[model samples]
Target: MKKWLLNILQCIQDIYQILKEIKALYNQFTIVTAHLQTIIRLIENYNHLAEEREKTVDTDQHQREIKLLDIGQVMKILNISESTYYRWVENGELQPRKKGKRHYYYLFDLQDQIAKCKLKGRL
Candidate 1:
């Protein structure tokens, strides 16, 4: 009877030790899971930032491809004489991008000018 009781106590002690080890492993697993979640969030944020940079690059490329117009095309679009166009240029109301001896204008710039003129009731 004494031997049987000792064997039972040893079995209980072994189970207790196993339970303690399992609890420690569970705590470590929780910490590892938290770290993994943080890493995933960082990766998602990096991907979002990369997507934004790509969009900015695409917009810059599009702007580079924007059409440039000459003086005659600008005069025809604005329906103004060459003298009036030159006067507006001298007045700083029209700014043209100059390359060597040629002056070029962006369509977007002309559209903005038209919008400003409309706002002032001049168009």
Candidate 2:
């Protein structure tokens, strides 16, 4: 019957539409995955560079000295914001000591850290 033939054609059209949609989604997924992979590679390269920079300047282990640095002072010295500094502290990226209900960074180790972070921005 004509009705049955029309119904079958509609089903085929619907299937084709679904297939096209799925292919579009697959392409989008590939693009997103490629972007993520590129970002990961860039992060890995930065980490490698940072590690190399840290290792290149060999310092003796016996010359240990401690120094205290304030938030604003450290921010100015490192050219980073208070939020970023605190984030680094929270993530254990930067080691901070709490004293008298305040957080402080060690000045002795900071010179090296500042160089490592490549301190950016106006803060």
- Residues 1-123, candidate 2: write the lDDT tens digits: 699999999999999999999999999999999999999999999999988877654342222334567888888888778899889888877776778878786666576666676744342
Which parts of model 2 have CA positions greater than 4 angstroms off? 59-123
| lDDT against true structure, model 2 | 0.77
Q: Which ranges of candidate 1 are over 4 A from the true structure? A: 68-123
On a 0 to 100 scale, what is the lDDT of residue 46 in model 2?
100
RMSD of each: 6.9, 13.6
What digit string (tens of lDDT, one per residue) describes model 1 on residues 22-69? 999999999999999999999999999999999978876776588889
Which candidate's TM-score is highest? 1
Worst 10 residues of 2 by lDDT: 57-66
Highest-scoring model, lDDT: 1
Question: Between which residue pairs do clashes occur in model 1?
Answer: none
Reference-based lDDT, each prediction = 0.87, 0.77
